[model samples]
Target: MKTFTYRTATDTAGGLEPGAAFLAGGTNLVDLMKLGVATPDVLVDVTRLGLDEVTSLEGGGLRIGAGVRNSDLAAHPAVRRDFPVLSQGLLAGASGQLRNMATTGGNLLQRTRCRYFMDATKPCNKHAPGTGCPARQGDHRNLAILGGSEHCIATHPSDMAVALVALDAVVNTSQRSLPVSDLYRLPGDDPSRDTILDHGELITSVDLPALAMPSTYRKVRDRASYAFAVSSIAAAAKVADGRVTDVRLAFGAVAPKPWRALIAEEALRGKPATRESFLAAADAELAAAEPLKDNAFKIPLVRNLVASVLEGLTS
Candidate 1:
């Protein structure tokens, strides 16, 4: 690891200095530092910045503080009742010990779990741009199938962020507020930066809009738990008289960002809530998928998962 200055943040302004990185849970950041992937000169601890409360919004929604722990957020009565997808996604992520420590903001800021990116000795375009993406022809079974560029094929590793994107959550930062859907940037020619968040910008809170539709989260991994997703789905659907009134879907572990299946949502909006409809909708969205050699199975895997989840919701 690198020697760096550490200080508790007094305010957001103090946390925004050059070459500074926020330390909330340090569950992900500390590991990267140890691996020599991240070496910020200043580690700004913002755990005591009074950003740990979960407040009810004036408009019947909820605003989750960035410092709020994943365990707390998942256990909140309001979250479990209103947004079960978020709660389920949180529970499906990391182990219990890590969930107790991982914060909302830090969870959203997690780097790709690609071995090449995490292994400093390897030549990963995500870690060192213009080098090369070894995972392209290597062990890329868990890498992205959608939104991946020739430069990189890393997958975003957050289940919570996928659920948030499906639920239309808004991330409030020191710079500006934007939908979680727009926060991530696709790896085009440059893969060094994962998010569109400006350097030193502090994420204060995330706002969840009141969604009336029923939603759920599903993660497919190598094991039942404690494993990163191979592919995951966050789905919300509203059915009336056996017809799909509305729907929202977000895919994880298949893209550089939590991919909102707008095409699928559009396809299912006024269609029947049946397994066939679900499959057709999924196909519509995946028509644009450009799966790599080792991960071509992701196309069928994601399609079947989407169909099954929507089938359950409608049934």
Candidate 2:
């Protein structure tokens, strides 16, 4: 551990130093620091910036501030009524005490819980790029199956992000606003970089569009509580007269970022809301997956999860 200076940031700009990291909730950052994965020389406390409000948008949408805690967001009346998927996703992660401290932006920015990434002794491309990824040949039963590169196959650990991606949420940062899909980048050649944010940039809020349809989030994990997802699906569908009118899907614990199932959505549009259609659409998307040796079960796991989520939505 390194000695560091601590300061409280009153505003969004002009407080960030060269090696400073914003601290809202230290749930993930503190863990990484203790593991020697992150060593910052400065800690900027942004918890009192007054960005914790969950306000209603003019057009029935919702705008959640970055500092809003996960527990509050999940239990908000508007969120529970309009975006049940997001609520379910938030509740599915961590524990009650941790969720009370975890913020919206912090949750979105949480790094992978990969054992290799956390182990400073191991060689992980995500922890130290160009070194090598031991999980590629080591214990990778809980790693990624889709959107992985030769350099890294670490799965993202955020359940809220998966739901937000499915809901087409936009991330508002101090630098610029972008879709949640564009917020995270796939590990192509640079596994060290987790997001597309520049240094000193800070997330301010997240905007979620109003969705008036059946939506759900489901996670399959090693245990029932306080466990990361082994395979998860966040889905929303609008079915009318036994045919799918519109649909959106995003997968978690299967890629570097939330795997938006655009191909599956395209295949399901205007198709009958039947088990066969769901299976075909799932197969269409899972066909591109390249599962590793130990994680091959994720191929069928994701396929069945996608189909089951859509089936439940339609029913």
Candidate 3:
């Protein structure tokens, strides 16, 4: 580990120096630093900038501060009642200790847990652009299946992001507010950049629109607990008179960013809420998936998960 200077920031703009990283929960940043994947000359502590509140918006939406802990957000009455998918997604993630320490913004910015990306000696394009991505032909059983390019196939590891995508959440940054869908970018030629955030831009809060429909989050992993998702679905649906009125589906652990199943949703809208309809919709979305050698199972996994999630939500 490198020796570094640490300071708490009272304001967002003036404190960010070159080679400085903002610290909130230190769950992901500290782990990356210990692995020598991230080295910072200065650490700016933003945990005490009064960004921890979860406020209710005027139109039954939610304005969750960046500093709010995962466990608190999951257990909040409004979240549990209105957006159960978000709550369930939070609970489905890391262990209780990590949930207590992980913050909303920190979770949003968490990196992929790809072995090549974490190991300093490996040829990872995400770690060092133009070096090459060994995961393309290596042990990538848990990597991305969709929205990946030749440069990188690493998957985003946030369960909360999957749910937020389904809920149509907006990420509020210091500079601007944008849809969560726009917050992440596919690693085209530059695998080093995970999100669209600039050097000094900071996330301040996340805003979720009103969601009053049946929703759930289901994750399939190698283990039952304290494990990242091998495949997961966050789904929200509304069925009226045996026909699907509205539907939203987003997948995790299968794409560079949260894979919103917009194609599937379009197939399901105005269709009868049945197993056949769900399966067809799932097929439409998974048709675009380009799974690698070790991760071909993710194709079927995503298909079944999307169908099952929709079935459960409509039931």
Candidate 4:
């Protein structure tokens, strides 16, 4: 490994300095550095600053410190009981040892698992600037077709993040608190960047608001567990008087970000919770889906998964 300056942060406002990257658990950053995907001049270790904690907020929301380990978050009794989606998502990733070392913040910032993005030899906009994206035309079976531009086709890779978006979670940063929905940037003109966070900003915590609605996360991949998603759905529904009052739906692997299917939610709200209504809502969200030649199956897969998730939520 190349030598680099390293420091331990003392406070949240502590400077990371230009050309320096914040180190939480080093789960993702260290791996990227070894692959030559990220080469920072300095690494500011924030693990010593005591940001690891899980606290209940005044309302029904929960506050999770950035430094909190994945294992802890996944196994927390409160999380397992109140936010099973979050627990389920985390438990579905990596191994027990890895989850113990991985931090909540690092997981959110984890880059796409796209093969092109990870392989230095391949042409990927996310890995090399202005080199162009090969996945757009070459191999796109596992890539994102929605919200993708001519520059890139990589999908965001975080099962927990998808659940967080559906739960209306907010990300607290050193600079400012941003909604999880607003954290990701669409791969439009710049596919190299995944989020709107500026350089040197450290994620402090993730705050989730009170959700009276029923929520669930459903992920499908080639492998049964510990594999990246091919298509997944995170959904929350509020049912009253046998009618859906409100709903939140986010689809993964189909878009550049954890795509919130608002059109589908709108269609389901105030409607009877039935298989037909659920399918209609899923169709509304995927109406504009433009699938690639090899990955056209994702269109139906996402639609069916969304329908299934909503169906289960109602049950």
TM-score list, all predictions = 0.98, 0.98, 0.98, 0.96
Error of 4 at 89 (Å): 1.3
> Which portions of model 1 miss their true places by more than 4 Å?
none
How does each model score on lDDT?
A: 0.93, 0.93, 0.93, 0.86
**Model 1 lDDT per residue over 1-315, tens place:** 999999898886533678789999999999999999988898999999999999999777999999999999999999999999999999999999999999999999999999999999999988887889899789998998899999998999999999999999999998899999989999999899998988888999999999898999999999999999999999999999999999999999999999999999999998999999999999999999888778989999999999999998888
Which candidate should be chosen as best, given lDDT against the real structure? 1
Q: 70-180 in candidate 4: lDDT tens per residue? A: 999999998888888889888877778889999999989999888888887788888887999888678888888688888887888888888999888999998999899
lDDT of residue 253 for candidate 4: 82
Model 3: CA > 4 A from native? none
Q: Over the stretch 1-315, how does candidate 2's per-residue lDDT look in tens digits?
A: 777889898897634768889988999999899889888999999898999999999888999999999999999999999999999999999999999999999999999999999998889898888899988889889988888899999999999999999999999989889999999999999999889998888899999998989899999999989999999999999999999999999999999999999999999999999999999999999888988899999988988998888888899
- lDDT of prediction 4: 0.86
Better of 1 and 3 by lDDT: 1
Q: Per-candidate RMSD vs. true structure?
A: 0.9, 0.9, 0.9, 1.3
Deviation (Å) of 94 in candidate 4:
1.9
